[model samples]
Target: MDGATQFAVSALINILTSLICITLSWWVLQNVRLDLFLRNPGGIQGKMLQVLLSIVLGHGLAVFFIDYLGWSGMIGQLF
Candidate 1:
């Protein structure tokens, strides 16, 4: 109930959210043009960078839209 406790809980939630976001992103990308991506069948090296980029970008985009859209939607909110 204290400041530290709240911070800890918030941090945990953020971590879980980011993890879920990354996983969701990877799954989506895997299905998208999967045949082309896996034409050579990346064993380990090829998939690693793609996975990392997907996670970082996925969480980043989510944060951007969530924090920015509410402000950007002011016109729609008026109508």
Candidate 2:
């Protein structure tokens, strides 16, 4: 791909990765009540903890998907 095309592909992948991560986090919290482990489960602290957990887990999963599974290459091909 040309430089411009490659840039666009990279941007698109980043956006999609973020969206997927947020969606997965929301789904897990809503359906699984995974934030119950927090001390103040219904307070701001709990909410912040949940957000942090989601971000870390999301990034970790994204790295695994891109590096270990080579899904990044598959996604790049789609663009």
Candidate 3:
């Protein structure tokens, strides 16, 4: 493949990755809220807490996974 083909492939991969990350985050919130709603059927505060917790947990997991994937690339630099 030539330069143009390589660039297009890379761009496509990047776009797909971004979309997946966003969708996963949304899923995290949606599913958590659903559970919370069922558990606390009459509590407004509980639902609010559920949304906040989901956002925090989702971001934490995202950072953790990114760092783990980057570990191999970083290993040799400190050697």
| Maximum-TM-score candidate | 2
Q: What is the C-alpha local distance difference test score of each model?
A: 0.70, 0.72, 0.63
lDDT of 2 by residue, 1-79 (tens): 8999988987788768866977697667666564556666779887777788788877776666556436656787897
Compare candidates 1 and 3 on lDDT and give the better one: 1
* Between candidates 1 and 3, the TM-score winner: 1
Which lDDT tens digits does candidate 3 get at residues 7-74?
79867755565555655776766555365346764479666666566556666665566667568658
List residue ranges in candidate 3 displaced over 4 A.
Answer: 32-79
Task: Sort all candidates by TM-score, best to worst.
Answer: 2, 1, 3
Count of backbone collisions within predicted model 3: 0
Output candidate 2 Cα RMSD.
Answer: 4.7
**Model 1: how far is 36 from its true place, Å?**
4.5
